[model samples]
Target chain A: MLHVFGHLNPDTDAITSAVVYAGLLTRQGVEARAFRLGEPNFETAYVLRELGVELPPLLPELPAGAAVALVDHNESAQSVENLAELRVLRVVDHHKLGDLTTASPPYLRFEPVGCTGTLLLKLHREAGLSIEQQDAALMLSAILSDTLHFRSPTTTGEDRDAVDFLAPVAGIKNVEAYALAMFAAKSDLGDTPAETLLRMDYKAFPFGDPAAPQLWGIGVIETTNPGYVFRRQGELLAAMDHVKAEDGLSGVLLSVVDILNETNHTLVLGATEAKVLREAFGVETQAQLANLGHLISRKKQIVPTLERYFAPDA
Target chain B: MLHVFGHLNPDTDAITSAVVYAGLLTRQGVEARAFRLGEPNFETAYVLRELGVELPPLLPELPAGAAVALVDHNESAQSVENLAELRVLRVVDHHKLGDLTTASPPYLRFEPVGCTGTLLLKLHREAGLSIEQQDAALMLSAILSDTLHFRSPTTTGEDRDAVDFLAPVAGIKNVEAYALAMFAAKSDLGDTPAETLLRMDYKAFPFGDPAAPQLWGIGVIETTNPGYVFRRQGELLAAMDHVKAEDGLSGVLLSVVDILNETNHTLVLGATEAKVLREAFGVETQAQLANLGHLISRKKQIVPTLERYFAPDA
Candidate 1:
């Protein structure tokens, strides 16, 4: 069986891309099963229902030691140690390289794009698969989320090309209208802080050194609403800080987006490394706050910027 | 079975509204089957598939043999002569009143919007039935098409309200993006003249007194590409003129739309009245060929303009 595994704390792109890609694979006579790293959020549920696609069952902790093919997020030895006992066939992602080992070195595809969905789209197009309208719509949604609805600068020609290809297939005359509507629906923040916090996927990363306290990055994506971003900022930062303190983290990074404007108000807590934020964004840090204007998506903006800051000086 | 029928030459609004309204009726213990007057074009197909919806089979020529519920387009005694044998229980449309009669006076819902989808949205929302994401997506598509993606001045607060209510349910963030994509997809002119002509729903309206030559109105809707308006003008006019000559028409009215700009280029072929076009649009006879600019929509703009021109005293 072709086992397709997606990243931890999966987004719409991570889940829908895997699902549609799996559908394409199945159509090609491949026995494929899709697995998600975490439970889906409200937005993902709405999209799946709209397309009449069933959400793949979430596999708790990666099948307790089965073969895995990583998608979207990079695989690490630490993350896959439990699953390492089983065979890993391939890895498809858009993230920077992480230390990963497989018995048989699998086909590793890592392109610098906004999201892994874009890569899957490229694969689908390259393979000449006939994309259905529902799948097209989902892929478009993933691109929008990854590229911040086409407002992010990190969006490339490939991203726009994919959107142009899928727009007609989706039968939507104005994708921006649909994006705005979907984002507006997501702006209602009536849930508790914990619920909101849990609704998002969080990833833990090694900071400076593996033992130098863990660092966590949290991303929240929504359609453009500056007011909503401004309102959620304090609470989100506080929650992350609380989580970090409880878990004993060196630092926690929170990226909340105003998708319409392609802007992200980034919050960094626990670390006095203003240089880290500064080097990442070229903006001088203020007392404790860093406002990365027009930096919307974590996938497209924050991560790459962080990678540059962490890289050796040119 | 509950008969869910929409206007002839069904657009996105007409088809989607029918589906959503049917779903609502079905949930309320009504066995509703959606009926369309003609084949769904590429644009309509995209939406149906994206929402995982299947367009109901075409209703061959109004099913004069079966009970019907007239929708969108108005009906007349001549139009229903075959259906006169079957009872028409209700008339749900968003067009100006048309000559229609039933053995027992049926429920008549004729609002002044561009498409009947708006009424379905109201009914679904008012009924308090849960509108699924696909249903909501379809409903939103209908509204966008009917209202020219909200660019038409004919759009009302009610239309906006329905859009606001349905947008989130569909998980669409930006309605314009969806609309643009759908419209661009439909701009292909690779089809034969007959196919292109048949792609849009057409209706016959006997204009003027019986003594006068019969006048027929034919319209074609494209989500985008106003250039097609000019390109197809001669062919459409010729087709109408041919039909007119064959049927001894006094005049024929044709409208082509650039839905994005909310503009319609119209050609009126007949000697009976250039005055109606002039009176309605404040266009002089000499300026008819000067590109009439944005004419809004056939239902909201042209019809109202014609009414005003025909009845200056009224």
Candidate 2:
């Protein structure tokens, strides 16, 4: 059986895309099961329960050469620890091409859309398969979460079309209401541990020369109420510092994204991250924060900027 | 305008797939033109002439950020000199995942099929576009050449189905006869320069640790007349030696594949190439030739074997 999954720090897209893709493959007579690298975020949990879908079980350590399919992400740093050892059967992703190599050719589908959900819908249509109502709901929720209800810079016409096509099938009458409720659920982080908050939507990235890339951990907290996060900035910074040292990361940052305002106010753990923000984004760090104005979409706005700044020739 | 092309040392699939895909994109209201990184091999030339289709012009160096699309191949080492600078808009490939990175997500479609033509047909269908007679002929020829008329181990069921579907559309009355003619055209190497023969279907690959990979150049000569290739062994070996030195490659290999017999007899340039063939395949070199029996598909058999042998853990 092929295990299907997405990246660690399971956001709505990462968690639900695995389920939708696994269901699609299963309908095509492939014995595949969805798995999560970590616990789903609050919004993802809300989506699963609201859609009456079961939470995917956490992935266990599999022996080398186990077949797997990846969704939403293709980067090894964001995937399973044994990614190199496993045999990747397929990848459905929306991120930039990553450090992925296979012994043989595999099925790969990547598009520059806001969400993997948009690509999954296309895949189902291409396969001449009817989308299940639950799967459609999962895809709709994921698209809304990933695109921030079409407010993100990464949102494309295809994404909007997907939502429009899937809304009725998913039994969603008002997408705006559902999206706001999901955001509310996402922001309902009452006294969650500092480390848990920092890890909810984090990913490790390698920059500079690929041979000896500098590893950095970046976390994001997307919510309508950014002030709620700012109140716990002290704890979040301490957790970030601890994670940076523990993971031997070159630097660490946590971007608190104001979803409604479409702005980014990133917390800097140290001088290293501050220097990168200053040099890479021309933003000064004050009071342990860097205001990366209107740079809310990490995949579109933040990561690419940092990638160019740390490029080997740069 | 988007320029579509394949890998260096363009083969039938490499040259024709670009033309077919470019035409597909153009019909969809995107201004895309096909280009070739290198001159077409004899078989590709025959296909173009027989179909009365113009040869894709050789690609010139483009300015940084020029929009481009890749077909047949994706690895930077096998691509244009300024591949890193070019903006890759889409990639339709049938090869393993390569060291490709982008600033943003791009349209990527990869499958472990025998030919890119199969995927191109699917792409055209998904786009709700009709395949023109000329485009169909190009795809059919590419599928036949790449799969060695379904003799190669890389040939899959989809490739056979594609050929069956395309034969009528391409207006080819006798499929077998057409395939034999293509093979004959590919085999007619009559007095071509040794260097030219060696480079007609060659690609550079990087193996071992990705940070500092060991680069090797692999060349394949697939034909119905293997005796003719072996007869020019000395000159070919000299050409291989010159390329290995000139390119500063770690190793160079030229495999002469007998399409009918389904066998590989590779020329070993030096001690480095000889040792790798021996250790990797357990085949002894005799008279500077290593018999890699029944390993006719380079993409399926030879490259993967070498990749595993050169793996960091291996």
Candidate 3:
């Protein structure tokens, strides 16, 4: 059986792409099953219902000793824990390269697109697969969610290409309507602050300092109310601070999404240089914390900004 | 197996709703499988792919004996051929009621909202089904597509309620972004006129003297180019006129959608009541034919306009 898996803390794109791609493979006579790493947050559930598709079973943890084909997330040894133990058969993602093993290489398919769904769309087209309507709708939703509905800075030609390809198949004459509906659904913040915080997927990265093994932790909080976000900023920071002190991390970053304005309010805590935030974000901050809006996503928006900050020195 | 079917010539909402609803049912230990009536059009395919879900297998000619659970389209024996033979087990639609057999019905869930997917979302909630991320995304997409991203006049409280329920699960903070992307993708009309016309789902209805039944078809044509639409109008009318004259139809109506503007331009032919067109559309026409712009939809905009002129007393 072909095991189609996506990254830890899967987003709509990551989860949906895996499922659709697996379906395509199944239709082509391949035994395929779709799976996701981590539990699906609230927003992902909304998208699955809209597309009339079920979420693949959530993998309580990464595949410890199963053959896997990864999608969406980077495939560094750290990203795919126990990678050496499992047979990495394939890698399909949209992120920049990590330390992937070339000696025992998998079928790596990485493109500079906004979502892994776009790459899968290309493969489906190239393979001349008979795309069904429901599958098309799912792919379209994945692209919309991953690219922040195509507003993310990391969106590239491939992302737009896939959207253009799938738009007609989805029977959507106007994409704006779908985007607005998705945003309106996601912007409600009536839940507890912790729920909102945990509803999203997060990643932890090594800060490149051996002395402080846990260098940084990042999470995204998508919402509409800037006031609510500002109100809860302290709580999030305190939690991050505690995690950082306990884990001996250098810094923590949280991207609070302002759904109405299509911007991100960045919150930084810990020992990272304020200059790093300022240089990457082009905004000055005196306090150990920074609240910068309009950045939206760390992978698409924040990471690029961080790269710019690191480019001059490194 | 539990057959989960949608309307003939299913749209994104129809197809996606079927797939997701089936998924939910299957998760609940029901042996559910999704089915579509006809070949999936372009937009529906895009939507399904985005969700990473398999498109249900195309039903083998509307189930001569199989029980059907209809979604989106209303159940009218007059509209659906061979309805007298096939067993319609259940109907979950969000449209004006047509004559249906409710006396010996299986489950019947009808709501006057923008889409069938909205009703499905309610059912998921009522059943206390825990939706997966992909399913939630699909539902979110369906809401946007059916409600014109909440801009359509047909939008109702139920539609909004469905959106509110599904947005968080889809992980969308601002649906406007998704709407914009979906609209932008649809606005690009590089394909031929026939391709564009076939991209959307279509339905046929009998229009004429009750004694002489004939098909007066109405199908949505999504495109941005008014000139292309204007040209296609002639071709569509000629084709429809040929079919009408051959089959002794009284008239036919075609709705050309300028998806970007959320407006419909109608082309009416074969009917003698040109004044009905004038009175309903506020556009005076000679030569026994009419072409009108700024209309909403054939069901919401054209039918009311025509009914006023044809059967003013009713």
DockQ of each: 0.00, 0.82, 0.01
> Cα miss at A100, model 3 (Å)?
2.3
Candidate 1 has what TM-score?
Answer: 0.46
Residue lDDT tens for model 1, B1-314: 65666766667766776666667767878677777766676678877877788888776554533666666654552233365356665556665444443332244445555456667776665456677888778878887766767787768777888888888889999877887766775555555474346337455654434334245555555547766556666666567667667756555566656776666666666544466666556665442332357775555555545544443234
Summarize candidate 3's per-residue lDDT along B193-264 as a digit string, tens digits: 553363254565544333344444566765545566675556666665665566454555556667667666
Per-residue lDDT of model 1, residues A1-314, tens digit only: 66676776677777887787677778878687787867666567666776788888775555533656667665452233366455555556666444443332244445567667777776676566778888888888888766767777667787888888888998877988877765665555455464355336566655333223245455554545556555666676677767767756555666566665655666666454456777667766553457788766565556555644553332
Docking class of 1: incorrect
DockQ category of candidate 2: high
Candidate 1 segments whose C-alpha is farther than 4 A from its true place? A60-65, A77-81, A192-195, A198-201, A209-214, A221-223, A232-234, A270-275, A278-288, A308-314, B1-314
* Native interface contact recovery, all models: 0.00, 0.88, 0.00
Q: Give candidate 3's error at residue B148 in angstroms.
A: 60
TM-score of each model's chain B: 0.83, 0.98, 0.84
Error of 3 at B79 (Å): 68
Order candidates by TM-score, high to low.
Answer: 2, 3, 1
Q: What C-alpha lDDT values do all the predictions have? A: 0.63, 0.93, 0.64
Highest TM-score model number: 2
